[model samples]
Structures are given as structure tokens and as C-alpha cells.
Target: MKELAHLNKYFFKYKFYLFWGIVFTLISNLFGIVPAQVVRHALEMVKANIALYFLFENSSLQVSSYKIITFSIAVFGVLILAMAILKGIFLFAVRQTLIVMSRHIEYDLKNEIYAHYQTLPLSFYKKNSTGDLMARISEDVSKVRMYIGPSLMYLINMVILVFLVLSYMFSVNARLTWFVLIPMPILSLSIFLVSSIINKKSEKIQKSLSNLSTFVQEAFSGIRIIKSFAKEEKFVETFTKESENYRKESLSLTKVDALFSPAISFLIGLSTVICVYVGGQEIIAGKITAGNITEFIMYVFMLTWPLTALGWTSGQIQRAAASQKRINEFLKIRTDIISSENKNQDLQGKISFQNVSFTYPDTGIKALKNISFDIKEGESIAIIGSTGSGKSTIANLLFRMYDADEGKILFDDTDIKALNISNFRNQLAYVPQDVFLFSETIRNNIKFGINGVADSEIYESAKKAEIYNNIMDFEEGFDTKIGERGITLSGGQKQRISIARAIIRNPKILVLDDCLSAVDTNTENAILNNLREIMKDKTTFLISHRVSNARLADKIIVLDDGKIVEQGTHEELLATAGMYRDLYEKQSYSETVPS
Candidate 1:
């Protein structure tokens, strides 16, 4: 219950729905006890009429047995029949209100969690797996729905039913009520023991299920690699182990859940037994009527229904509590990156990094060290580096994927940190080294981030990225579905689609982090030539290893060992006869001697 307190805001948000559900639950339970009382009165009235007739034997004023029986039947029909229908109607209403509210909350929660995921730093995503996050949103949220909706409704119904029945029993015969309630303490203790075990097992089951989900997601995502490596058997075995663990945990929970009903039923049976004995004795001693004992028995039976349901309801609560704990932990995570509270200053794309340094949080290895550079608006700068030389890291910093650990990065002389992150990011377009295109149509993929951009703009951007002709070659043109992760498209096609996606955004700065490596040199040259016109009025940073790509930039910077070692025009770097010169000579010589 404490774990579920985080839902208070949503509960209040939809309090009107909850209020009606609770009211209906109460009404249904109220009507639920009327049938038992009606049965009791019918029996008492029939007995009373028989006694009256016997006392007035041979008299014309004697009550008729047929009239008394028919009248009792009428009372039975009116009270019991009508109440049963009313109870069912209200019960249906209860479900409609509460269950609907739970769905609304679940919908809201999913959106909220997704929005939070977006706000989280890139490091958080690196630490967590996609499957684990998916589990939280899908499975964990359903568990929470159980707690808030049907479980809660039934719990309230049980309380109201128990209260009305207990009060009526005491009113009819206090001593009998006392005797019958003797089993309560034992019942409570058993529920407590079983609930504790249930809580622990439920948590394990949820965690095992998450692990299973993670395994499946990873296996599918890496299926090509697994087939190439011939490790399908290994993955299958691992999956089998995870599945076994999940089954064990679920069975453990089921075993405890199995104990609840029988334990509760056995305990409740004791109350019924006590009611019959005490009630029968009271009737025999003439302290109470037979009708009173019959009514008490019926009330005990009424109590049995909720008590039996209590077993299942308790298990549901324990499982939901476990789920709520997991959900709460995920929601409570504070994003490492917080945008500025104040409105951000306008950016003109005058980018500068003053002695910037950064290290990845998990590895603690400096990806960029004491890096300093500045690029004026509309200048095309190229970065050339070997693998792990911080070329992509520079692009990441510019996009605010991860902030620099030391010194400052600025846009238009305004500190990047002082600018609103959304606005700052909106001013930049980045095409990362690893391309990711969603399983959408080519048109939608190109027009993803930029809304209201016409098909004409999409076509123009596609042409600029040198993918328009390839798209037109497809049977469906822009409407074709690319399958999961664009698996149907070639690597070069996917990269070009990603470039087209960025080109349409029309940002103040563009960062191409090895986005053209999949394409042949000729295609890369054609795309770069088109990009030159688009980037004429925007700051462009080209991160590539190819000298052919770097030579096109107005200025080129060489990086080695996470530091900028050389910076100048490509000719100036070649004249220095250093690292850049060696790279150029190797590329140029390779080109001349190539097959």
C-alpha cells in the first residue's frame, strides 16, 4: 500500500471516477445482504402463521396457511429477487468505473515514463537495457492496474459486506456473533504469513520475467550475429535457464497463493461451525427463535463469499505492491542533464570549445581531453582522426548528448549549459555513425523530426542525400515499409535516409559523424557536393577518416589519442610533413594502386 502511494496524483486526477466506483461497490454490498434477511423473515413468518392457526383451531378468524405461504413468497420475490438484480447492476457499474480509471492511469503512466526516458542522459540508457525498460512499461504497468482497479474495487466491496453482516449478526444475537468471530485472529495471522511470502516471490517472478524479456529482445536484435557466429545453441540454452528460473519463481508464488483460500476457508468453516452450535443451543434454551439461528447461518454464508474472495485479493495486492516498488524506483531516477530554468538566448551557430574535457561515466576513460577550437557561423570544418580519437565525442558534446566535464562549450558565445537544452538541440542536426531508421515508410522516415514539411521538401532532401533515385526505384516509392529497423534497405540506403532525415531539419549546425562510410566514394562525393549548398549558411562539422571527404572542407583538424594534434587547411597539414601528411600519402598512394 505504501509502495502504491506514488499514484496519489493520478488517483486525485480521476477522483470523480473512483468516487462513483466506490459508491457503486458500497451499494452493491448493501443490497447483497438483503436476500439473506428476506429468507430469514420468510421462514419466521411461515412458522408464526402455523402457530397462529394451531392456537385458533376451528375458528373462522384463524390465519389461512395458503395465504401466509403466498404472502411470504411475495415478500421473498420483492426483496431477494429485486435486490439480486440491483446488486448485479451496481457490480457491473463498479467495474466499468474503476477498471476504466485504471486504464486511463496506465495510459498516462506509459506516456510519462516515455517522456522521462527522453529527458534522461545518454549514460542512463547505456547502463539500462531496452528490454528491461520495455518490461517496466508493459508487464509492470499491468500489475499496477490490477492493484488500482479490480483488486481495489473488490477490497472495498469486502469491507462493506463484512461490516453490514457483522453488524446484523450482533443485532440479532451478540453472544452468537462473539462465538462465531473466534476464528478471526487465526485467519488474520495466516493471511499475514502467506502475504509476506507472496511479496518476496512476486518480486522474484517479476525480475525473472524481465530477464527473460531482455534475453528475447537481445537474441532477436542480434540474430544475424548469432547465426554468423553459430551461437544459436548457446543462446537457446541461456534462454532455457532464464525461462526455468521464471517458472520456478511463478510456481513458488502460486504455491503460497494456493494456501490462502484453503487456509481462509478452513478458518471460516470454524466460524460456521461455532455459529450453528451456539445458535442451536440458544434456540433450544428458548433465548432465541429458530428463525434467528437460520438468519445467523445465512449471514455467515454471506461472510464466506467475501472471505473466500479475500484470499485472491490479498495475493493481487502483494504482487501489485512488488510491481509498484519497481515502477517507483524507475520513475524516481533523476536525469543527469537539466535544462536551464530561464529562457535560453538566441543561437547564431558561432560554436567554440574552450579547453573542454570529458570522460564516459561507466568507463572513466577520457574521450575528449583539453580540446579547444572555434568555428564561425556557416564555416565547414572537417575532423579527421583514427578510431577512438574523440571525433564522434566532439559531435556528441556539440549535440549535448553528454556535457563536457571541464571548461566550456558555447554557441554564439553563450554557454551551452545556460541555454535550454531543447532549443539548443533544435538548432543542430546530427547524423550519428551508427544509423537508426525506424520501420516506417521512406517518406515518414525522412519527415520524422520536422513536422508540416511537405513531400516536396522530403524529395529535395532525399535528392541532396543521393537517395531519391534509389527510393523511386522501389515498387511503392515512398510508401514502402522498410521492415524492422529498416532491414529491407541496404546499409548505404539506410545511411542516406538518415542523412535525408537530418537535412530536412534545416538546423543552424550540422554534425555528420561518419554518416557516409557505407556508400562508395563516388556517392559520398555526390552527397557531400549537395551538402555544400545546404551547409553554406550553417556551421557544419564533418567527422570522417577519409582524406577525400576531409579535403573538401574549408579547414581540417586532425585528432590523435583524444587530443587535437594539428589544425589547418588540408594543404597546410600536408606541408607540415607530420601525422596528417602520412595519412594523406597513404590514402593517395592507395587510390593510385587500387584494383
Candidate 2:
């Protein structure tokens, strides 16, 4: 209940529907009890008419008495039928209000969670699996919905029916009513014990489901790798193991849930037996009639379904609480990267990293150590480093994907943190070392960076990336749909398409982090030539290992083991015997002796 308290606002938001639902439930139950009373009256009337018929036996009054009895019974039948019809109508209204409110709340909740996911820092994603996130939003929300809709509706209906039925039963004979209620305390104790076990098992089942979902998602996402390595059997075996575990957890829950109906039915049956026995004794003692016994039995049976549903509703509440607790865990998370609300500032592309230092939060490894560099407006600087030399970290810092743990980064002589994060990012284009494209057409992928882009702009960007000819070679040209993450395209094609996406943005600053690694030297040179013209009077940061790419930059910064070892023009770096020269000589020799 404490965990589910988060939904109070939503309940208040749709209070109108909730109010009507409760009113309708009360009216339906009121009508529902009328049929039981009608049955009791009919039985009493038959008993009285039987005596009258016997007294008028073999006389003219006997026929009149029979006719009166027939008419009276027919009238009672119509009254009972009317009560049933009215009850059904009110029941329909109850569902229309409460069920609809539950649906509305579900919609608002899902959108809220998804929007929150978008605002969370990248580190949050690193800490959580995609499947667990999906489970919380999809599976957990659905469980909560069950609590809000069917479980809640039945609970209200049961409570109202019990009050109405019990009040009438006690009015008729308090002693009989007390005898009928003897099994209630035992039933309650059973429910409390079973409910605790259900709560614990429900949480375990949900966790198992999350693990199963995570495994399936990873398997599908990496299906290509599995097939290539011929590990299909291994994957199938692993999937089976996960599935078996999920099944076992579910069965365990079902075993506990199985106790609910039988226990409720047995207690309700005991109440009915008590009613019959006590009513007979009352009749013999001249305190009640046979019709009273019949009515009491009807009341006990009337409560049977609600008592059974009580068990189910309790289980639902426990499950919803478990799921809501999971949801609250994510909703309570606060993102570390809070964006400033200043969107009016403009970028001039003069960037400086003043003694910037950073460490990867997840791994606790220092990726950058007292790194300092500067880039003037309209200048191109290439950062050359070996693997793990922290080249990509520089690009991440520039984009503000992460903030430096120490020192300051400035853009146009202003602290980067002070600028509007959205506006600052909108002015920059970044092509990461690992490219990702959606399952969209090539044209749409090129136009992804900005909305309302013209087809001519898409074609121009594609041409600049040297991918226009390859796109035209396809049957659908730019309209060809790339599969998930551009799996249908070659590695070079995917990289070129990603490059076109960045190029189409026409940003003031461009960060290409080893984007041309897959393309041939000829294509690379062609794209670089186009960039030379486009990047005129714009800041460009080319992060790569190749000296061929670095030589064209105005300045080259060589990094070794997370520290800047050298910085100079290409000719000056080649003149000196440093890490940059050693890398250049090695790459040159490797290129000459290639297979």
C-alpha cells in the first residue's frame, strides 16, 4: 500500500470517474440483494397459500385460492426479473467508469516513464539493462493495471454486497447470523498467511521474468554473431534454461494462488451448513420460519463469490505493490547532468580544455590525466592516439555527454557548463567511432539530424560523404530501407551513411571520431576533399590514428597513455623523433606491406 501510494495523484486526477464507479457499485449491490428478499417472500406466500388451500379443500373457495396463489407467484417472478435487469445495468456503468479510468492512468504512466528515461544520464543506462527497463515499463505497469481495474472493481462490489447482505441477515435473527459467521475468523487468518507468501513469490517471479526478457533481447540483438560462430545449439540450450527457471517460478506462484479458491469455497460452504442447522433449531423453538432458513442459505451463497474474489484481489494487490516498488525505484533516480535553461547563447567554435581530467564512472579507470589543448576558431586539429589513448573521451567531453571531473572546458571564452546544453549540442555534429542508424530509408537517415530538410540537401550531404553512387546502385536508391542498425548495408556503407547524417546537420563544429576507418583510402580522400571546402571557417576535430588523415590538419596532438605527449604541425612532428613520428613510420611501413 505504501509503494502504491504514488498513484494517488492519478486517482485524484480521474476522481470524477472513480466517484461514479463507486456510486454505481452501491446501486448494483442494492438491486442485487432485492432478488434474495423476493425469493424469501415468495416462499412465505407459498407456505401461507398452502394452508388456505387445505382449509378450503372441496369448496368453491379452493379454486379462488389456487388462482390467487398463481397470480401472486407470477408477480413475484416479474419483480425478481426487474431487480436482476437493474443490477446488470448498474454493473455495466461500474465497469465503464472504473475500467476506463484505469486505462487512462496506464497511458499517462507509460508516457511519464518513457519521458523520464530520455532525461536520465548516460551513466544510468550503463547501470541498467535494456530488458529490465523494458520490463518495468511494460510488464510491471500491466500488473499495476490489473490492481487498478478488475481487482479494485471487485473489491468495491464485494464490500457493498457484504454490508447489505449481513445487515439484513442480522435483522432477521441475530443468533443465526452469528452462527453463520463462525468460519469468518478462520478464513481471515488463512488469507493473511497465504497473502504474505504470495507477496514474496510474486516479487521473485517478476525478477525471473526480467532476467528472461534480458536474455531474449540480447540473443536477438546478437543473432548474427551467434550464427556466424555456429553457436545456435549453445544459445538454444541457454534459452531453455532461462525458460525453465521462469516456468518453475510461475508454477510456485500458481501453487500458492491455487489455495485461494478452495479455502474460500470451503469456508463459505461451512457458513451455509451453519445457517441451515441454526435456522432449523430456531424454527423448532418458534423463533423463525422455514422461509427464514431458505433466506439465510441464499444470503450465505450470495457471499460465496465475493469471498473467493477476496483472495484473488489480495493477491493482485500484493503483486501490484511489488511492481509499483520497482517502478518507484527508477522514478526516484535523479540525473547528475542537469541542463541550464539558457538557450539564447551562441557558439563561436573557439574551444579550450584547461587541465581537464576525467575518469569513467563505471570502471573507475582514469581515461584522461591533466589533458590541455586549444583550438582557435575556423581551425582543424587532428588528435592522433593509439587504442585506449583517450581520443574518444575528448569528443565525449566536447559534446557534454559527460562533464570533466576536474578543471574547466570553455567554448568561445565561456565556461561550457554555463551554456544551454541543448543549444550547445544543436550547433555541433559528431560522428562516433561506432555508428548507429535506425531501420529507416537512406534519405530519412540522412535527414535524421534535422526536421523539414529538403531532398536536395539530403542528396548534397550524401554526395559529400561519397555514398551517393552506392545508394543509386541499390534498387530503391535513397528509399531503400536499412535493416535494424543498418545491418543490410556493408560496414563502409553504414559509416558513410552516418557521415552523411552528420554532414546534413551543417553544424558550426564537426567531430569525426575515426569515422572513416572502414572506407578505402580513395573514398576517404574524396570525402576529406569535400570536408575541406565545407569546413572552411568552421572548427573541425578529426580524431584518428592515421598520419595520412592527420597531415592535412592545421595542428596535430599526439596522446600516449591518457596524456598529451606532443603537439605541432604535421611537418614539425615528423621532423622530431616522438610518438607521433614512430606511429607515422609504422603505419607507412604497414601500408606498403599490406596483403
Instruction: Find the candidate with the highest lDDT and give its number.
Output: 2
Q: Estimate each model's TM-score.
A: 0.96, 0.97
Q: Per-residue lDDT of 482-551 in model 1, one digit per residue for the tens?
A: 9778878889999999999999998888899999899987998899799879888888999998888887
lDDT (0 to 1) per candidate: 0.87, 0.91
Q: On a 0 to 100 scale, what is the lDDT of residue 254 in model 1?
A: 84
Residue 355, model 2: lDDT of: 98
Which pairs, if any, clash in model 1? none
Stretches of model 1 off by over 4 angstroms after superposition? 51-64
Off by over 4 Å in 2: 58-60, 340-343
In the range 232-298, model 2's lDDT, one tens digit per residue, is: 9998999899999999989999999999888888888888888888889999999998988988888
Give the best candidate by TM-score: 2
